[model samples]
Target: MTKQGAGQAGVGQRWTAPQRWTLAAAVLGSGMAFIDGTVVNVALSALQRDFGADVGSAQWVINGYTLMLAALILTGGALGDLYGRRRVFGLGVLIFAAASGLCGLAPTLGTLIAARVLQGIGGALLIPGSLAMIDAVFGDALRGRAVGLWSAATSVVTVLGPVLGGVLIDLGSWRWVFLINLPLALLVLWCLRGVPETRAAGEGARRPDLPGAVLATAGLGALTYGLIQAGERGLGGSSLLIAGLGVAGLAAFVLWEARAPHPMLPLGLFRSAGFAGTNALTFLLYGALGAALFFLPLNLIGVQGYSGTAAGTALLPMSLLLAGLSGVFGSLADRTGPRPLLTVGPILAGVGLAWLGFLGVGRPYLTGVLPGVLVLGLGMAITVAPLTSAVLGSVSADYAGTASGVNNAVSRAAGLLAVALFTLLMLGSFRGSLSAQLAGTSLPLTARAQMLGQSGRLAQVPVPDGLSDAQAAEGRQAVRLAFADGFRQVCLWCGMLAALGGLVGFLSLRGAGRGRQGGGAGENLHEPRGEEIRAGQAAPGRR
Candidate 1:
């Protein structure tokens, strides 16, 4: 090699070493949050069995974490800006790892729920700071590429969460699901040492809105608890009271944020019609996505007789579309605009879900499920990147962080609300259908009681005992049909909501893409950050 060539090679090695560590820390840190989110879902049924928890507790195990996450994430971002980004980020890692250990060791459902809530608090700190750290370290020229690299690596792990969880659950107990985070967390902490601390320079007086965080968390908690209780107890005394408190708490939170000098969620961001509309569309689309995902595994494993691992792997095609095709769609939206892609994507998603609703009691996976899965995957791939572009693009740089924070909150709330509301409807439908079906059919009184007790569980409801082979077969058929009927109803709702989201996007947004129209920015905003923000559009429950 020439002397100049050797010099260039040495220079390349120097630059490559730090960059590799930074990207590694970011990818693993954010991916830890991502993987944990989906892996827990795979363990939900196991949690139910292990803790003797009812379906409502299972919902709480997931929603409790998500609730804390959505409500506190904006505050978390602010905390990082005020405190050192790397310091807060490191603290988040330690907290998350410790919480994971607690979750793994939890002896009861209540204990597990508490641990999950702690995990969410840790996640709120880790998520925003992880990306912000990359922004702080990399110069403007290289920032976009660094963020893109981070998104690509993390997204792969997010998609693999269920598959990994399934393998762990099959090989061992559900405890391993939470335990799996330990090694990953340790890796993140080790890489983070090289990441320099960064913080907002001028805003030393800014204190995080602690009151806003408290109210939002409390309000969402009450709402979720009330909704879950209503499934078992109807609109009774406790449910009504708790739900009322939830409404009041949220109302106060809104009122407080509007008036607070340093607000966690700035109300003024909603002043932009384009931004507001895009988020409205996001809520609807993500809600539908959440419903489909929450129930898909149950349909596969509980009703269709697939194993946990097989059921988990079934979603691979959809995840691949999200992970692989998102970058392609990101490019397409650059030439076009977000509007057309956003409008078309949700419509396709609705049709795919509509196809899913038609899946019979026990149909073949290829014919009955694969086609819809592939279609839904494509639809999601088309929308996510463009939708993210429109969201971040809609706001000015001054308000960009808070704006993205609000949009992120909306997506998480969409999932929590969808699961809570739809599960109620499914239960109501399931009970009525089961009662009517069994009333005329001739089930024994004991069998009737057994089915009624398990009605709220829907597909996960067990096959009852003491029945002969012929009777058990009939019982299983009846139960399957009931579950299918309820699931179909929910799927129909999902399809309709997704279509409505598409319609909203069509009317609210300009026909051209964010790159073309500029999202009120009056300048094009097309770049690699589009890949990162767009890919981040998916929540843990998205696929």
Candidate 2:
């Protein structure tokens, strides 16, 4: 077949049986990855209780997957272009399901974290190929519509994930959350038989940037460890030593990417002011979002006296707005350009967070948090679609796949780092508040030491062993007050992050005209389909 014919062959054709099956498989696989991303957050308190875990370990459970996903996802995209997209996508599913099974069976905190790391690795591979597989099978005319359907379908899973996880926790146990993936994985594999195998035309024996992947992972892992440790051991602890090494590793990775022939990430894209600023804004905003999502459940279930399901459903307003309004906002950005939405969205988000920070202890959800949730939801809805447009617009059409991968990776990294760093803020504030609150009370020394040891529990610290019934009641009140104070401070810090994100976009992305903008490929949060990734596949291969 001629090149032009190959390009046009599937365009406007009836969706063949295989094509339908292929799209279904890819959508389900990506949904699995997406659902896992949000579902795990709601299950965190349950994990802590089951594992008898400390705060740092709990953070690691989340970060382990995120760190691998952020660091290695680009490699996954590159691999799809080189190896067959269908083959790699299937491998990723197998790995992810197996990892999920391992997670269900994990007997200890260490084991659970290890399983999650493996799961992250699988996600990195499958998430990129999930879209890329559809790109390979569909013709150019149909690819965009196919991807839109895929995105919409996946977004529904994001909304359902937390609620489903909550039901699993309440109905059975947290282990079921991991175990549930097995059937989904099986269905994906069954659908795979209809998928066409395709790879980008490339040079003979092209190699992946394995070293770059290693360096990035090492750096992020080390730095995250240090941040979590900093909360426990202070800056003087040995965790700082590891963190310093992480800094060095990252610095070295940057230098390597600049020179490598098969660079996993092309650094030159940062030269575009809009590109750099969009990404910077992504980092800041996602960091704040991650902190809020990670901790809100802890506050609701553990401190605010909500049920697991209640805590899970609390963010319905935000998630639903994001799903329902994203396309509308995307069209608006298309008409108005990204500057206004980008600038206004973060500010709204910041204001909402500040309102949440001021919530008094044990207030009702409807009055205390719902309005702030709505405002934050509106902010995210307005920003996300425009943000995607800005990122794609910032780069040349040629780099859409690479740019999208990097942006997605950055958002995940932001969340990973936020959870680590914010955990520190929570600890510092909690300890200080506890110290002051207990100073005037006659709590026994053992009681104080016990509270200190449970620092990782945040608002959920268990009752101390030796207190009298009357003293226990008093101690409970003191712990709750201290935790509440700390939570307020954490919320305030999130507000600062969102505000700073807004500032970054305002200064860097705004151009000469009001709400006017140039254009590029329309890259959304999901991996771009078609030639954006395929375009680069022809290189590194001998004719």
Query: Which one is best on lDDT?
Result: 2
Per-model TM-score, in order, reads: 0.92, 0.92
Off by over 4 Å in 2: 1-13, 203-206, 440-442, 512-543
Scanning candidate 1 in windows of ten residues, the lowest lDDT window is 524-533
How would you encode candidate 2's per-residue C-alpha lDDT over 372-490 as one tens digit per residue?
Answer: 88888788778877887787777766677677778877887787888888889888998888777776567887887787678677766777876788878777767777877877888
lDDT (tens digit, per residue) of candidate 1 on 178-226: 9989999999999987777788778632789999999998888888788
**What local lDDT score does residue 488 receive in model 2, on the 0 to 100 scale?**
87
Candidate 1 lDDT at 57 equals 69
Residue 35 in model 2: lDDT: 72
Clashes of each: 3, 6
